[model samples]
Target: MIKFDGIAAFVATAEAGSISAASRRLGLAKSVVSERLAELERILGTKLIQRTTRKLSLTENGQTFLPRAQRILREADEAAAELAARSGKLAGPLRLSAPVSFGILHLAPALTKFIQEHPQIEVSVELDDRFVDAAAGGFDAVLRHGAIGDSRLIARRLATSRRLLVASPAYLEREGHPASIDELQHHCGILYSMREGDWRFSTEHGWQVVRPKAALRANNGLVMREAAMAGLGITLLPTFFIHEAVKSGVLVPIDVGARAEGAELFITYPRDHGASAKIRALADSLQRSFGNPPYWDRLAS
Candidate 1:
């Protein structure tokens, strides 16, 4: 007889693309996940995944069995939900994902409050800036910033963050500030490697784009903030990350009245499960916590 636990572990490994990722999502130890996968493969007498240093990829047998496993699990979940609904109770582990910097600066604090309010719910949060596949990752919710892609995921707008140009006062003193938008061409920029060269802005002449030479470039927002604070160069960053710094005079807005392409913060989750109470509760919490027009939007340019 095949063990359902082993089979479910295999399915999670296949979907997550790595044993470590599956372990984190499932709240299992790395050794346990490995043991489960090995047991499942032994029972089936076939390899389920091609484990590589870079990532785990599903084998032919694994791919063929994935949808079947997912369907079985979904049915089980539906059955449990139906039974639980009769008692009118919400109980289940809720998995969530969010950008690393945003999670550190915003979601992490909110989660502390959420956990206090809902003691019955168990929560797991994954912090990464890379685009996440919620269903594949087995996440119940994802907090993302930017234009929400037109997908099956249900995205609830949490707040809007304005894009602002900022630099440390020291940098301005040393490098000389740009007097106008046109003069920005002569100034150095702290480039965000993730967005790289596709900067859009709103100015007196309306929308404008600039490709400035970067004195430094980094992939993470916190790193960019550090660089800017150290008087590196002017950077176009979301006000959410720099508002406090600017308010404290650690950083100053460069083009005071200019606007830029802003991104909407969203709480996105898989639509396949419809809206579960877990999803709704977390979404509502986020809406209440940051939805009242985030302080970033009110930052003085």
Candidate 2:
């Protein structure tokens, strides 16, 4: 009979490239890891790894067996998770990645409720604006806006993020609102540096693209929003960020007789291993919390 511990140790050691590294990863002593690897090699009657004082390398057999070992470990984990889920006792660490603006303004509150409901599940969230490789980053899931670029990932649409062209009431009153897309070129713009300098709007003829001269260009949405609020210039922003300002009459939406397309917010995970119960539960919680129109949009309306 094959010992699962031996298999696990072998896989960890092969992946980590050294027994010392694998021990740290698996929370096992180096001697225990070496014993497990030795036992595994004895069972198979083959030396899987070439160990040297300077380095570790996999044998041809080890290279061939690595994928199978990984798959077995994955299957075993899934099976355990399935049983725990069936018993309604989901417990595990769920690591997630999300955008900075949305994480701070929206996801933070949702996570508070999620933790309250599922006390056994431990969650670690990384808030970043840059694109993250969820699989490589070892994240259980990632919340992202716009289209999913990686086809290897499974994506679930969480909500639609509507954007609007907005300016502070004082700014509009002083500078006067542009009546058409062409006239927007004459106005000062507060641009998000991450996006294209040219703004696109749906028109009766077709899509109209206008590049406005930027008075201020910023990477952070909050910074751009604050500049716009200070009567700097007209800016394009998602409703999630600007909704409160709009509702409070600090910012006024510009009626250019055109609408910008809404970006889709998706929760994406790797397709290799299906989502675990804790991940599924977190997704469910976010979906329910966001709702159809989303709580933020509804509140603003």
Candidate 3:
């Protein structure tokens, strides 16, 4: 008989791409996960994985068995959830991923309150700007801005915030603000490195794009915001990042009669995650915390 634990260990290791990562997700020791994988192979009388120092790959047999194993685990998890729900108690480990700036500035406080309310749930959060596969990375959920690309994940929009053209008073005082979108070419720009420095706006005539000359470029939003606040150059940033600065008079918005586009923030999870108790609890708390208008935008208003 194939033990459920052995099957779960194999599935996690396969998806996570390594024993160490799988162990972290399962909250199990490396030795335990390795032993379970080895035992699963022994019971089946077949080698299931090819392990080298650099990486782990599934053998042909392992590849064929992976989907079936995943199905079995999903069914088992659903069954367990049903029982847990009956008792009105939830207890499990939840792994989450989020972007660095938002995670630090926003998610941290929300997570603190969530943990306090649900003492039985063990939570782990990984903050990074790099895109991660939620299912393969073993994350229960992840926070993202803008559209979600993966078809296998379901996204729930938490809130929406507009991007604004902003600069320090000192910079605007010295260089002067551009009177129109066409004149933006003459000014220096602090830009987010991941995106093309193309600024888009809604004008009465139609939409317009301005590819600004970047004087300073950084991958992180906080870095770009800091540079802009230091009188480096003008930057287009999400209101959530600079709303306080705009309110405090540290940064001022430059309205050139162009309406900025808004971006939606989402909490996404794998479709196969199947009504996870911990995920549902955290999602509810976050939605309520952010509210409809979002607290930051309210502060800005």
C-alpha local distance difference test of each model: 0.78, 0.84, 0.84
As for candidate 1, its clashing pairs are none
The lowest-lDDT stretch of 10 consecutive residues in candidate 2 is 132-141
Q: In model 2, which runs have C-alpha deviations exceeding 4 angstroms?
A: 1-76
Give the clashing pairs for model 2.
none
Error of 3 at 261 (Å): 1.1
lDDT of 3 by residue, 1-301 (tens): 8899999999899988899989987889999999999999999999888999999999999999987887687667656766776788666667789999989888899899888887777788999998877755656788898889888899888888878899999999999988888888889999877776347788887778887888898878899999999999999988878889999999999988788777778888888755577677888888788777888788766
How much does each candidate deviate from the true structure in C-alpha RMSD? 3.6, 4.4, 2.2
In model 3, the clashing pairs are none
Per-residue CA lDDT of model 2 for 1-301, tens digit only, reads 7799999899888866799988986789999999999999999999999999999999999988876887687667667767878888776667789999899998999999999888877787989999888654556689998889897799988888778888998899899989888888999999988878447788888877777989999877788889999999999888888999989999898878788766678899878877777778888999888888887677556
Q: Model 1, poorest ten-residue lDDT window?
A: 77-86
Provide the TM-score for each candidate, comma-separated. 0.82, 0.78, 0.90
Error of 1 at 14 (Å): 2.2
Segments of candidate 3 deviating more than 4 angstroms: 24-27
Per-residue lDDT tens digits for candidate 1, residues 176-206, read 9886666777888888787645568777677
